[model samples]
Target: MAIGLSREQAPPQAVEHEPVRRRRRPVLVAVIVIAVVLVALFVGWIGIRAVLARQQLEAAQPSASAVVAAMRSGDVAGAKSAAESLSAHAAQAASLTGDPIWRLGEGIPLVGPNLAAVRVVASATDSVAREVVTPLVGVSATIDPRSLKPTDGRIDLARLAAAQPVVAKAQTAFHAAAAGVAGVSTASLIEPVGTAVDRLDSLFAQSSPVIDALGNSTKLLPGMLGQNGPRNILVVAQNPAELRATGGLIGSVALIHADHGALTLQAQEAGTSIGPWPTAVSDIPDATVGIYGPLVGRYLQDANYTPDFPMAATTIAAMWERAHGGTVDSVLTTDPVVLSALLKATGPVALSSGDTITSANAVPLLLSDVYARYPASSQQDAFFSSAAAAIFTKLAAGHLDSGKLLTAFSAAGTSERLRIWSAHADEQKVLATTTLAGALPVSTPQAAGIGVYLNDATGSKMDYYLGASVSAGAEVCRFDFRPTSLVRVTLTNRAPANAGTALPKYVTGGGTYGVPPGEILTRVVVYGPAGGLLAGTQLGSDPVRIVSGTDRARPVAVVPVQLKPGESKTVTVQFLNARQVGPGLNVATTPLPPNAGSTPDVGARTTVARIAHVCDSRVK
Candidate 1:
């Protein structure tokens, strides 16, 4: 080995490999630097997209609002312009949210759900802008609500029919958009994202009913308004001063004839004069009679005792036909509140009695003051007839602002102060889906309904001073493996402390019905969702006897509440074994005074599973 030691033999391999390793080190460093730069660029791009998308969404809201406002105000050009702006913002937002890189970012751990929520909102907004508002704006120029106003007592049905198809499409698109937003889960979303999603959900939920009603009206209006033949509709004016289940006791009745949208007042009479029919006017179900009693059939004023408006309208129409000897194709019920709402459009009318009835004084003059001014039934009837005539004359003059008129109809209809029933099966089929139909409480795929109806047991106008509100809830308990739902109805007597001595005898009933003067006896009727069972009822936290019955397959409980002046009471009803549940609950109460705007509270325990979708025995 010593003999072979030379300079080349010492480190030939080391010298050759040193430069190669140095070159490779620089190349590896460059690769890592490039990779880091690429990742940073990707993240930065996503951040910029998110910001732009959010800005687009925020900007679209005002455009959407403007479109709705312009349409309501009958500015078709403004609506179109706003619609275009909405479309632009919504499209860009949708595109930004739908990008592949954005979709990939939706998989990130803590930020993923928020990203997904943003995407969902963007998609829904874009769909609504492109599918719903755009088509509606396209037709807005042709189908003006103002054009539908009565001209010489006739509405132009042709224009309504022309816009029906497009209106129906918009309704369908709206429902789809609503479903898209409703399907997104908010559990994992951050607070801001969850709140934004919830707000969009609420808009869809509230607007669905209005859109549905529009579609239904356009579908049924032509036939119901006598496009095929002449139709006789009975208009029953309900007096809310004396509370009834639907609105109030029928005060005045008028007959209207409709031929191809032309309306004419054919005859007028007091509801009191209709009958005391010798027997039941229509064959009523025993269940109905058991709940409402025979008075509903024999007396026109008692027809609304049943909370079902169709039954009430049927009886009222039958009684009128028997007395007047004419066919009644339909029946409509409205109270003084509705008339006052319409007065805003009709302007002030001078009554034959030299009194001016404006929107401001219509309610008091018609409901409270009229009773005090004319004590006798006949004199009251004369005044009502005169007032009705004066209002009708003003309406016939055709000087109304159509927007205000529609707004009046919407307010009255939503509050249950106005209702309509069609005798024709086809027309009724469409109407049954509407609030105007006045059907009983039933659970749907989207909501569960409970009804709290008030019927006066006092034979007086004392309800003029009554105020009521309703709230409901459900419970879930592990120890108790049964469903339990509770309904609370709070009744307040707003009457003066000296109502016993200060009020008119007619208004107070003079204690004729065994109730003390100024005391209100209300038969409070509570109905649970269809196929539910009544567990128990309480009056002010104490158990009480309830007169129980069933209607439309729903459990009903009747409790009598007697309240003195300046008194308040709360009635509670408990329901068990609900046959169905829905994502939300709706409580339908008797329409109270216009000033009493009740907000319904309905919910279930957060821990329960399928509480909104299934009727589980172990949960409410």
Candidate 2:
């Protein structure tokens, strides 16, 4: 029929279908063009919102820091202004990220989680700025850390008490904000978005502790500083020249009495005046006696050998009570490094001997030069006592730059150069959670704890020139599916080649304790992660004798090494079968001399690199 219907005889239906097909093509093209335009508009809207939110966040981030700085400096007006700025910027950022359209984008396929994370971060940041930081700014003048400084030898505890409620409220709000930010999922996020979330989380985590410390200070300091009654605080000045697990041997001891915030130096004495007791001053823990020997309680110098500051403080307090009868309250320990830190606040202190100790010269003068300047123990002790008194005299004048003072204490606390132990159970419980307490190494779910402690066995000041460093790594390349950890400690004798003849006999030990002159003898103790076993120990490439024991359920390995002048050694301890240990390592070492250049070059160790990667894929 179609062949017959050709030329002028074409069918009517065929003619009609051609024009319809032609018309539908134009309509289809129009529909596709409209769809492309709409999609472009939608993506552009999301991009604009994200850009605005990010810009607002960038503007607001600096305000929180400014508020903290201003409040610390006791500038109420500046703090208030910063708080307002923070509120304004954070609120805008939160609004931009929380709109209906922005939330709708969070329901999209591939990029949904990224959008969701940004929104969560914005909301949490706004909540913290408005809820915690702004309210805290109101009470900033009252709880200023600078204000906590002793004015006329008395800190006004009433200020802390008055601000307690505000600080507590702020702490609660900050924790909630932190938890909220922590809940955001980083997976499936774009690189920039993931990184922003990570940095935000880190800021929250870091600031949470500061708030916690503030809360703790307001809560605990009033009672401990004797707002209601008299309290005694023992001050131990540790000398790091002769290394001990906790800084060094307690060289000088002092007692301070506090009543209604008033402080008075009750008494001061040399550590030698205290006991090498006839027996342990208190019942020493079996683990302590086994790892550190009974000398931990017998001798004041050996009290900190166990690396548990509370135990050490208790033993020292007992001995102090025995020698000078009084109720023991709390103990504070500081080393020359801490003294150097404090010196930055006190300025240069002039001694009676016409010598000056500045922050620049404090470490060398106190830890080394003092030994050389005084040949007799009595003379050295007198010099130390005089130096302590001079520093105290400067501090008592109360003319300090409050910022410098706080920085000094913060640095000391961070490095564990300064530590405190309270006799009160409640106070100790709080202190246990802080680095200031010098508690034993604590393992968390994210990190495995290991401790490398050093004690001087040479009975000399030689450790002033001894350098030490600790590096740790973990491996899961075993068949048993348990982690294997290694803690490597490098010890170097930085003494001069002629130290035997050039150094004083007292400083060199003069062959005392079977260590040759100018030689350093150190007893190294390694504490494995809790519930771990000591596989073995190595001194360089050879097996070394290790006295194995357990402390606080952690396996302990002790090794002794003696090095002559200009010598170095490495001690490695292997820990096996550690249960529930994280992929990361938390390694703590004894505080070394400020001049000790002992930081390990981890990148140079191929073994560490290989083993550190074994758990990368398997662990979370």
For model 1, residues 368-398, the per-residue Cα lDDT tens digits are 8887788898989999999998888667667
Model 1 accuracy (lDDT, Cα): 0.82
Count: clashes, candidate 2: 0
Worst 10 residues of 1 by lDDT: 600-609
Global lDDT of each candidate: 0.82, 0.83
Candidate 2 local distance difference test against the native: 0.83
TM-score against native, each model: 0.84, 0.87
Steric clashes per prediction = 0, 0
Which RMSD values do the candidates have, in order? 6.5, 7.1
Per-residue lDDT of model 2, residues 1-620, tens digit only: 33565666865663458888999999999999999998787788889989999999999978988997887677899999999999999999999999888888889998889889999889988998898989888988777767777877787888898888888888888888898888888888889999999998998877866788778878788988898789999999998889899889889999989888888888999998888878999878898899888889898888988898888899999999999998889999987777777887879999987889877777788788887788999999998888888888777667676668877776677777778888999989988878778777877655668888999999998998887777778877565566777778888998998988899999899986788898999999999888878877889989998788999989999999889878899998888646744556777777776553232111121122212433332221
TM-score, candidate 2, is: 0.87
RMSD of 2: 7.1
